[model samples]
Target: MSPATAVVLCALAWTVFLGAHLALNGRWWPWLAVSLLPPPLFAAAPLALLLAAAASGSVPGAVLAAGCLLAGWRQSGVNSRAVRRSSPERAGIRVVSWNTQHWNQGREPDRFYAFLHSLPADIYLLQEYLNGFEGGEVWDIDDEERLRREFPGHHLSVDNNSVTLSRFPPAGPPVPVGACSLRVDVRTPDGILSTYNVHIPVQLTVMNPLSRAFFQDMRRRHGARRREYDALVADLLANPHPFLVSGDFNTSAAIGDIRRMPRAAHDAIGANRSLFPASWHARWRLRLWRIDWVFTSAGVRAEQYTFRDPGGLSDHLAQDVTITTTAIEEMNR
Candidate 1:
């Protein structure tokens, strides 16, 4: 093949791949195919194509590269600010959300307990409170006595695998929202704050994407994930109290699940200035996908939002958010 022909072919392939990332939406078979793929592909693939186009003097390749750049920017959720304001409002309540993989069951028990003690938060919305998975099955982890001893005065609420430890008083009992989330209401100084601690089902359990079984499992898991999103959205829509949803969603920013979240609530990470703010896969320290997130209702604003390293305690980074109620809402309450 001629050099020009080869360049054209490569550019066309890259364009199709990049376009797929931008065009696909919702929990469906088409989206499932590329959902688990890393965000880094969005960056690297386009840059490589742009360089090839520059070397070959291909206008069409350059145009495609521009499209890819736009796709990357949109998919990465980059905001205008370089970084959000670091100083948290004194009146805001600080919340620390993390998916501690079978809390304190892993290698360093001392470090894990110490790290939990160190986070400066009034409320802790923690997921994966179970013991680590054994033989593809989950085992319970009962740390109630120990947690009471450690946290001292905090109110503890446990629903299935999710847990919420709060310094405030409990406004109501824990409510399970489907199998993906645990809803707990706490009466803070401002008013009642409804919090949902979520851990959505992981996508594509049957790993090998090339096989028929993989596609079948993908379809099943996608449907399950969609149901979880719908259930939570429905609950949020009907909720009267100002709410905060925080946990390991197991869904990335690039996918449709994030879009399925209620429009009434604002993404806490939206305030982040960095283009690629990742929270999962801390082992490699690549921080490629941000599967964990925190969202707040209209009246509740995030004064400060950030992702902190788990310090080798878990595979996911910790999300620390300081949220405060609007004055109008506080007065009405």
Candidate 2:
């Protein structure tokens, strides 16, 4: 092949590879209109081969190759920490925080119960636990009861829309912080670990049909949501205890306000720089938003944070965190 022809083919391949990355993420509108081409351009084998060859030898080429590989890896559904099990420690804790959409949404109550049962966690922090839905009627009391029955050894506390399924009993009632946040001291084998389960009101930008309509007045509603979040964090900082704060914060990990939370409030997900992009998403798949998070105070140490793919069940994936109080004490010392 001619030198000029090879260069052109290489460039075309790189463009297709990048386009596929963006398109799979639902981020190909302007390019789509400009090119007047379908998404199959990204999946073409010739383009993949050209990009791989072009990315050889040079640093920039290597980086480009890595990017293409990573993008393809995510799309292939094989690149995740699914089989990686949490290490068992003599004196540590395993906590799993998930929005769970609603326990009663897609799966039957029994199947949902089974799914929760399968997880090996000392504390399961759940957001969107449906006490009531649509009209003022109880939605998943039976499922809640099943959880209590299945985990008879643990204490179950439901505050507003959040729920805590704990292996130890709570020291007091679940402390409510505004309409969405809650704090409670659970008695663990090691000590009384205060666990905060928060479901910050979904930002106005991502609110569903009903919430979108309710918060149609953007400035007022968004301001209220921000204020509510500020107040909740303030309250948490004031609370006395080595705590684990978990739930769906409804903001991205890149937000300045969230980043400013006392360095003590470390995000486990941030530990793995490879998983989510440093830059947050703006829309679904274009996903600049990382509303769901798990933050820890000084008293806790996160051994590992795994962001598992949704497995097509919920819109957001599950954040599986294995933390130990030993890390917290060492940090304090």
Candidate 3:
């Protein structure tokens, strides 16, 4: 192929790949199924294309490739490179958020429990508190007794599929949010904090993309995902106390759902420093997608944030965050 022709193909390839993530992104039908793939895969396509074109020594192709990358970067999700640390004297609450896929049933139960014991978090927001899928069918799991026995000091709040075990006593009973999420008002040393443990439904299951069933299921799942996001957004708006929300949102940095959150909401990961800090599909060393997140309202600040490897126990990494009150006015009633 001619060098010029090769460059054009490379640019077009990148354009289509970037367009999918920028435009489709699980927001619509058939294309929604395509979006299930990690967005980083799309974001990285331009880089690969750029290298191929540049190797051809085609200046225009290299320039066009660079432009595509810039566009991808602009639309890419938030990531922070700068580490924010708290003052030694400042008291911060350590919150650990994790989606224990099928709980301990899928892994060695003792090791799973031991991993949980190692985290020195004040509050634990856990999801997928259900039994492992058996031949594609999932059943409820009753681990409340075991959880209580394992973590003696914390109070447990169990909603549908998520659990909130807090060392801080409950200020009130757990509020009904939705089937995929749980909210609890807890009394903290700083003040009453509204904490949400969420597990938003995935957009689509892996299947034959060209099949009619795939699109149909994608549409149904999209609708369900929207309703869940709407419920969570509504609660976040009406909540009066300083809040923290953490979970498997089943959303990427590129999705509109996370953007639908309150304008004042701050990411627990702090300011955007890195481009892709993925937390799911742990087997992939690159960790292409960040489906799990930790977000806090205006009054709260995340002093430290980190994602812990689950040691093949689950598909997602655990989010460990240290949050402190930024303003007395916001935390106090």
Q: What is the per-residue lDDT of model 1 for residues 1-333, given as tens digits with 9 covering 90 to 100? A: 765556667778877865665667564565865756665666666778778878888878777877777766545544435454555345678899999987878567678878888896789988888885632577887878887888887999998688799999999899999886899989877788899998888876645668888778878878888888888988888888889999988877666678888778778776555657778788774667788988988778887778888888888988988888763353122
Candidate with the larger TM-score of 1 and 2? 1
TM-score of each: 0.86, 0.62, 0.84
Error of 1 at 111 (Å): 3.4
Question: How far off is residue 273 in model 1, in Å?
Answer: 5.4
Instruction: Give the per-residue lDDT of model 2 (tens digit) for 63-165.
Output: 4445555454423312134345544444457787777766557556666666666677888887787744432254644456677778887788887677788
Candidate 1 CA-lDDT value: 0.78
Residue range 1-333, candidate 3, lDDT tens digits: 897678778787777777665676646555555555556554466777777776787777777788887776634553534444434534589899999988988578899989898897899999988885632678887888989999899999998788899999999999867668999999887788899998888877778978888778888888888888889888888888889999999888666567667775677665323446778887667676788988888778877777889888888999888888744555322
What candidate 3 gets wrong by more than 4 Å, as runs, is 1-9, 16-21, 48-67, 74-91, 106-108, 271-276, 283-286, 330-333
**Clashing residue pairs in candidate 3 (N, C-alpha, C atoms within 3 angstroms):** 79-272, 79-273, 79-274, 80-272, 80-273, 81-273
Candidates 1 and 2 compared: the better one by lDDT is 1
Q: Kindly give the stretch of ten consecutive residues in candidate 1 with the minimal lDDT sum.
A: 324-333
Q: RMSD, model 2, all Cα superposed?
A: 9.1
Q: In model 1, how large is the Cα lDDT of residue 213?
A: 80
Name the regions of candidate 1 deviating beyond 4 angstroms: 1-11, 23-25, 77-80, 83-91, 107-110, 206-212, 273-275, 329-333
Error of 1 at 87 (Å): 6.3
